[model samples]
Target: MTSRNTRHHTVLAAAIATATAAALMGTALTASAAPRPTAGSGRPAAAPVALSAAARTGLLRTARAGLARTAEDIGLGAKEKLVVKDVVKDADGTVHTRYERTYEGLPVLGGDLVVHTSESGRTEGVTRASKATLKLATLTPRIAATTAQKQALGLAKDKGSAKATTDRAPRKVVWAAGGKPVLAYETVIGGFQDDGTPSRLHVVTDAATGKKLFQYQSIETGVGNTLYSGKVDLATAHSGSSYTLTDDTRGGHKTYDLDHKQDGTGTLFSQDNDTWGDGKTTNAATAGADAAYGAQATWDFYKDTFGRSGIKNDGKAAYSRVHYGNAYVNAFWDDSCFCMTYGDGTNDSDPLTSLDVAGHEMSHGVTSNTAGLEYSGESGGLNEATSDIMGTGVEFAANNSADPGDYLIGEKIDINGDGKPLRYMDKPSKDGGSADYWTSSVGGEDVHYSSGVANHFFYLLAEGSGAKTIGGVDYDSPTKDGSTVTGIGRAKALQIWYKALTSYFTSTTDYADARKGTLSAATDLYGADSAEYKAVEAAWTGVDVH
Candidate 1:
């Protein structure tokens, strides 16, 4: 989810054919150099596991009991009481219960953790984002709410437009960073930025000293395009006299028009007829049509490819809002509303409503429900990359000629006004800002640019290292280690990545953890010594993640 424009242009000359042949030869040589093992190459297929009735009841009872025993069960201090936030029982009979910590009736900000238990109530493991103990000197804040609010507003003004407004009151909470916990006030400020970008800033300030603790923007921006998807059939609900943009096939997913407004659910799109759009932005229904079609395709892709029911796997669809803000240049998926919002690009003629963009934004919801990756640092990079990878997978799965699948992200949007993509998976550094490979300092880079490491790894794992044509798009990938990689094909590659994301990844997983997670996933799906597993290892090594 990178909206930053790129100035570099990719030159795809006819000489790529020769490079493609050489790359293929290198891959062949690499494969010949190390023959694959066959003994542990495949696993016996097993049926999906299910939780027993007694296990479900036990988990429910544990959840309803305030989860107070979790502290002792998971080896926490007596002062730490975990409140259950969510309880998810996996198909393998593993119960994962998420919790938030409160110390002496005060909430701990970074004290959230997930406890994994077996069906027999045996503790398996725990995943915690912070290792620091929740101990604070005082519960009362020295700073007044009014002063905190003013400080937050001033900070927002410094980073945003002059017209930005702050209307919400500050909230008191514990600020936890670097293993230290202190009383703090959380302030939220929202409005349009000076550059016309939307802002949803969350600022934290120390309540005792009035020092700024941290700040993060809630608005996640990325790039898209309407403006064309060819003539296609749409799923609409027919009322007495008109058709509504609701798809019954996909849990009644609907598309709405925000009419340049920023908040609340907009109006449902309806018309007397089913036909929509003329491949132009002049018609309002045109953007809605593209949105509806994109949602349908994304829904079908997830269900057909991964057997996932919906974003939460709850057999429910998330709605979409189009034409958000005036000349808005981005789109985002907000979990608070459980919906996706699109904006009209510069001048209102370029709406950010495309198939892959839809998939990308929706995948964020999927990631939230699954791994719950924290949106910062290396984990944040992984979060963004997961969307890009899965979104690209959806595009290929759709196989639509109007928007053929490619590794190039936001290619149709012209977000940079140069007709180049926002990112290039084969060689991410081509975007100028993105990293070509992983490094020790990668976590310090912007999540969008740090995401390039994983994107490059996925490209190598799926298509190998060299020049290749996929979905009518040419890609020339190079390895950081100058080693040739033999791909396991996109299908198998996507399978491994999905398995890792849903089953193994956690909120604080880094690049090294990701390598282990993907390898373990490949082993589970393929085998411990399978070619796919070896390829996963090689691909990570190619990205300098080892």
Candidate 2:
């Protein structure tokens, strides 16, 4: 999902003006021979009408229609809209576009769209809209470079990363979670942080299967490396336990232990990054809380929707590592560990660790183990959209008051540095340069923003009719045919997309592949002639993908 696309965001105004002139006139006109039309001109002899609120909205709708290739391609849900403004011509008299919108408390930087023209007034050659969010500053190097000071503070990448070597020594007796006899490996990780903190650990293994059953990392709490120090007591009745040791002056020494008891369900391991304002308790607490919510959402989306257990379909226990790589701005899943990681922001610790962000990262693991979608071109876009679709479903499944279900991504994380949602499903271009539907050129942009086409398709498939409000948000979507649209709801749309991701999609998939996949998935869920199928087709058609 991190793969880069080549679609640059810079837009030339002269090109757009030429395109507008071509679209307005019946024939091509040389720049030297044609008289320039003024902005806001409704006639062919005049420049294209100055972009108004209505016109901007219309342009987004048109883009959706042009790019969409299936029912799943026009699925922009309500509660989101693309707002474009601040259009200016460069010294070369070429037009470059920018947009402004607020999310949470920050402003989002949108991409640029360039316009090119043919001789006829008929519009042609509108090309190259670039992504704007790249403007966000890079993550802080200090946080990424510094290691956790103590064994308690550090959550190793995995037990394997911290495994001790058997120097042909005799086997050592290790105690299991129940304090029973077992074989174990013991070791110490020195130079834990720049300040010379150390990590002590013991890992127990299943002699028969060679599988790791338990890992214990010590917790140390102190003041400037001279205070309270001790091993954290993490009592585990079942599989294992984890603890984060902190040096708190107010409380002296503290350890937060996560243990597995004879309980109904165990903890989930998944990491999602976020840059918040705090480096200690508050931020850590939020990561813990988000992890819990994310696990629940993932389980619900799969179980309630598809009747599947955790990622492995065998109820495999997963782990999550938070505060990875200092001020890390993005979250991702590592296949080797089958876990997720999160990071804090550079400017204000605005952690990218939102609910959707968590789901998105974890879904990447799912995709990797399943479709193994190559993160480039059409397959790449599908991969990104798959994360988004499921991620959105996870948000809606939670149905929380703080973060209501919507089609928007990063609405809570403030990833834009300005408080604005990262992308709009109804119109991906609101973030500037994002194609609302499938485009041959889609494979040419950044995966983060290029994902807009598929995101829009999902929105359209779920909510066919435009200009309606759902789940407490307003969306004024327009259909390609100017017909009313209807949605099959986010829940159903996710079911279809997941089924497609795991069972239908391949490395070369594009918009057409997505269309067939969803239709088949819908037929499997609802009858072939069911309203769901009808809605899917209608939604696709609304975006000009029938």
Candidate 3:
């Protein structure tokens, strides 16, 4: 995540996302898959458990067929229509289908929901982003759409945005997160930030009152490179005797050189040889190699650890852009481009393309596609924390000897010349700006700081409190309530968090909701009375989220 700017992304329906949402039914629906060795993890992927094309299609059909009844059960009006966003299935035959709602053909912000059902299609529960009843007195706006766009651009310029403007006009949407649903305008502005980072700010304005509802940067911070990871194997493509950074095996993911510019995809890296770098940053291929490795590792981590094929689970690869802006100290993930961009760090010597950084940024795409967490407040904090948690999981799963997995973010990137990490998961408060526990005002803090709560909980649950050494990294995580807690393995904790994120989380899920969702996920994976379930409860309490 951009610790400075934040890890927030906008919701843009890419070609693949649109196709999957409206994909037609297929045949032989089942949960069987051919075993494939994971290049990132070196283990057989969890493909057998992941939903196959047939399975996804069948579930989508079932969900679409029952959409009307599901809306009625959830107390929605006749004008509301459900569009399937994603489908997750467990080995026990439980299904969780996520859907985006529309009111009279206008997209509804914070109208996302997840429907849970049993193997026999019996309703289990439903998670809604907004509990407010849907009823719009009128659809016509009092103000002009051009006015909304102008206001949004003005707001962006006020925030130090250069060349602030939008190519398309503001689109009508229903805002229903914190209060009653109302007609609103969503304006997306493109430009450059004060730091020369690419700008993609989203502004939501109330149509009737001409009041701004919300504004956020869609360029979520994220990276890779020979700068950190030592010599590593990369899935490169060969064309006409030249090897390119394009990886065909893993969703055709490619790495490009931005050539120190702020925008646009630069040149693709190609060489006569596949071996990339000599463990240094001077060679341009060094960062390219790292980015390729990071992408492969992250892809492998998700596919091997959770059976997720890709960020969207559509067997598609998101590309990478490096060498962005001279001395650009930050890296980010842009959902609009479906790519991760890295900047050459201080003096162009330190590239921010560390393994964990890449995992962290790409995980933002995962959150954007799944939970669709808004990039502000408590939900925003969880969004950031989700990246840290999963990014750490990616680092560990990589088992890279050059850069051992640690419970720290951006450690090797050396954003600060003194060799300090961007954030600490074991003791997030160590960073001074981050909160180690939950509080009423936690939601008011910057997402990067408030994220300390969930990050601490994961640390306590996985490694427990007090002194410990893992992968040559020393950690002394503490509990908020001064209570001694027992440790659950990282595998179990990661699984629980992933399940909660996919099956239970919504756009507006706060820390309190997070506690309940994780508990429910644990109950589904393990028994309600199992030790793992109890540990999840204890971990939440230790973080003061109870």
Candidate 4:
């Protein structure tokens, strides 16, 4: 269900980055990003790629070679090790290599950093998630791992349904996120959350102190197209005088039916006719069409806009599953199966299969693959906001007349029964549960509601501050300091965000880190003196992230 979120190949977009886009030396960084057409401008983006395989390999090699000196500068213990996680480059040949730290080979939570260097391998500056020097007195845990696992599962069962379970027992990790670094156990709980959404809750407990340290759910609420595209052509495969919802061009992406059940991939949709959906929830084909189309559009958006291959940035595509359960009301993306699942809403009348919803859910995959932002605190808010931002981008990129791009999310689904959207970007606070500005307590709220801050920031960055009507919808956006902000256009905003997510952001990146990462990304893409950079600063200020 995306209202919330395709492709033409080779000649697809004129302004987006392609899979083979070369690294052309530019003022922004190293990779070239041709200007993209703004939303509702009836244009598409199909520019060059981010960085070639050789460039990425070179960046990683440079980062690893200088790891000893870089770790020493950060005051790390001799036992600490740095491993390059991902590498991205700029148009000016600047490379940002993300690294994860390990203390005595034990994973260190919140101990990730991005090392920025010039094309000549000269180290510039480092953005560290945590600056703590990890050196524990002992590796043994006073509390048994089984004890921690039981405690975590018990808590998950409390927050989850009766069937709540854990796939793996608690494992040891260095909890360096807050205060002093301590040995802790990280437990992952799976099953349906209390609200019926699938859960990937991570619970961290102190091994020495016998106290729970942290817990977060990775599968938050967030997946497409036939139901929304309105008589559009589908890129399906032909099989024995029939058609199947299998797209080989986009990594053989397929759509399945859960058959009103809660488990498994269900069945693949097939028929004599290639056409799918009537834009109504009358048959199973309608929802299948929507889901398949959503997947296609999302794939195209990433490929054309950012030159992203797929959710994992590999050529492989993630599958989609619909008709998940009876009256399930919500849809979600699950990483365990690398697929999406949807529900039948309101006595199974509404499928929760809106275009934006599909885009929102699938964007969760994008977040998981890139920054892997922790699904808690300010970072979780950013995660949700990223989905909303990308979902909006998906709508615009599709350029569907029946559902043209808008700042409202889930507007077509009638989720609230009052024809109100699940969220509003221009003025997120208008939804009543979201925050309009950043606050210390924002982290404690639900990720969906706390996402309002980043959502408002993106809105200001792309649309500006004040009252206006866009896509036939009314909006009145305000600022924390009552200062006016100008938009830098959605196309540029998307570039800065994608660059930041892939390069500067880490798993524990909070709102503060997001502001910094995006500012740096803007500087890398448009230069420090450009209006886009200034607008990014102003937008974050408007959201009170400063």
Per-candidate clash tally: 0, 78, 3, 44
Write model 2 residue lDDT over 126-173, tens digit each, in one string.
211111122212212221111212221233423323333221221222
lDDT of each: 0.71, 0.43, 0.78, 0.74
**Cα RMSD, each candidate:** 8.8, 24.7, 6.6, 7.9
The sequence of per-residue lDDT tens digits that candidate 1 reaches over residues 1-546 is 455552111111000000000000100000001121232423212101233445545666777584767688877777778776545564445566766677777666656566766667777666564555667778888989888888878887887545667746788877653346778887878775554545666677789999877665555654122356777788889989998999988888999999988777999988787787677898888899888888888888777766666776656799999988888777787666788888888798788788788888888888777666655667767877888898899888888888899898888777677788888999999988898898878877777888899999999999999888876688999998899999998877887787677655655567887887787567656667778889999999999988
lDDT for model 2 comes to 0.43
Q: How many pairs in model 1 have backbone atoms within 3 A of each other, for residues 3 or more apart or on separate chains, i.e. clashes?
A: 0
Candidate 1 lDDT score relative to the true structure:
0.71
Residue 454's lDDT within candidate 4 is: 93
* Steric clash pairs (candidate 1): none
lDDT (0-100) at residue 304 of candidate 4?
Answer: 87
Report model 4's TM-score to 2 decimal places: 0.87
Largest lDDT belongs to which candidate?
Answer: 3
What would the TM-scores of all predictions be? Answer: 0.84, 0.51, 0.91, 0.87
lDDT of 4 by residue, 439-522 (tens): 988988676777899999999999899998887888888999999999978887888788888876766677877887787777
Lowest lDDT block of 10, candidate 4 = 6-15
* Comparison by lDDT, 2 against 3, better one: 3
Runs with alpha carbons beyond 4 Å of true place in candidate 3: 2-48, 223-225
Model 2, runs deviating above 4 Å: 1-283
